[model samples]
Target: LGLALDKPLVAVETLAALAYNLYDTEGLVCPIMDARRRQVYTGIYRFAGHRLETVSGQEAIGMDELLGKLEGLDGPVTFLGDGVPIFRRQIEETFCQPFSFAPPHLGRQRAGAVGALGMQYYKEGKIQTAAEHRPEYLRVSQAERERAERERRAQEGQG
Candidate 1:
């Protein structure tokens, strides 16, 4: 609605905002959004005092791969976001390091966190014109994949 309201926009990375949900906690923070096909949109973060620092940038990756990356990091991890519920069992079964899931109240996406992060970004001169703002989708949509597959099959038929 920034465009409609003629207001400058601040783009808060979803994973970063989700990690901010645990700004008060110690150790590593992981925010995992279910990206389907057994993959998640995730990032590793830690709070250096009150400032959140990125241990790993957000990306679309399989749960196994993410777990593997976490194994190399020091200290316990606190996981949050939609992927927690879906991957909890697997994480418990496979992850070797100590970890805990965020309680239900703080597990999912929250607008408050996003707004707070957005405000921080604005203070840091990260604001952009509404026309310059764009949503970041970490991977191609299912529809796009399906369309590509269909084109490939059509080319095969022609050959």
Candidate 2:
């Protein structure tokens, strides 16, 4: 409708949608999404009565910091997203409990789940203008960060 109406199209964050599903379907709390390069797009959520309530929204987090947050929680922590592959080894080494990985089908992002979750959020007064929506990349890529660091060092040497 946004396209036909010539209105701005708003999209919810993928990580947020995943978090919502964990809360709604699995009765889990504080689902997190790895956004690669040791960073994550995370949120704190819980099921309240008949509906899900978002205690926190999108946030940029470091892998170690996220693990610490999970350690503080009482239940099993699960991870899903393309970024998981990047940090799988490190995660397994760092955590003490048995970690779970979603299968190929459920691990990747899916539009169907996103749309359904978005609808639920829309009805709960969570909808926003397209201008307010943005993909949660969490952090600058490692290449970009390294390039900036190199430039900084070059300038430092010249001056």
Candidate 3:
């Protein structure tokens, strides 16, 4: 007899994970984190009655585009992660409303925060078992994307 699989797998991108965590714990609005090298992990959250839910599709985004979208929202925002220095200038230039950064100690990935948020989501029907979870990497690596584009162009030329 074949081995039986027991659980479903859910591949959540890093940003979505963070956003969900934040929303589930702190009830913050539109939390965003930079993943490095001009990429962002971002999403929006709002409080409804007793809980927070994400408005974003839980997707990773490029810096410029994410900034543009955030700019359009016109609200107070906070940023976290190691990418702060890399995109400081752009973020400052783009975000018109008040913005702030989490301290170095609080920034970056924290299992405690994740667990706290996860517990909230768990209570609200978002929990998944160990066998059900996977990491969500929003964007392809630069090399992979470039290669795919090259291949597409090559195929176009051939056609």
Candidate 4:
């Protein structure tokens, strides 16, 4: 751990790292992780002179909604991540712009990609102490949603 090593920690955003997997590719890079319930953890990105630029920030969003946002963007989009296999059919049926899936070998999350991006962040002075790091979940967990629903039902019954 960075704390034990006395080194600053460089946190790389998941979606950004996923998009980095396609660093050599051209056009837009869309990394979509299956978030279930017809939604995905995704973001739109593009490379500008070896620097990865975020066209859209990461978020947990519906597949349809994500597609809608991509619809307006120009150029062919390269899709990757676990969500591709799950939503391939829907994307084929609904998406009008040109697109292609990353080959299986490069489709999923890779540690190399994360490390590479982490290094980029580190060089850019984005390092932080381990205690200052935090995970960005993008949305509440399913268990939390279920607990809230149960609480609401109990309140309704008591009322």
- Specify the highest-TM-score model's number: 4
Select the stronger candidate by lDDT from 2 and 3.
2
lDDT of 1 by residue, 27-76 (tens): 99999999999999999999887777889998999999999999999989
> Order of candidates by TM-score, top first?
4, 1, 3, 2
Identify the runs in model 2 with alpha carbons over 4 angstroms from their true place. 1-10, 20-36, 44-56, 130-137, 140-159
- In model 3, pairs of residues that clash are 12-136, 13-136
Residue-wise C-alpha lDDT for candidate 4, range 45-101, written one tens digit per residue: 999888888899999999999999999998799999899889999999999999999
Model 1, runs deviating above 4 Å: 4-6, 156-159
Query: Candidate 3, 44: how far from true, in Å?
Result: 3.1
TM-score of every candidate relative to the true structure = 0.89, 0.64, 0.65, 0.90
Task: Report the Cα RMSD per candidate.
Answer: 1.7, 4.1, 4.5, 1.8
Error in Å for residue 106 of model 4? 0.7
Every candidate's lDDT: 0.91, 0.64, 0.60, 0.91
Candidate 2 local lDDT, 81-124, one digit each (tens) = 66567777877899775456554356566677677777776776
lDDT score for residue 156 of model 2: 100
Shift in Å, residue 18, candidate 4: 1.4
Candidate 2: clashing residue pairs, number: 0
* TM-score between candidate 3 and the true structure: 0.65
lDDT for model 1, please: 0.91
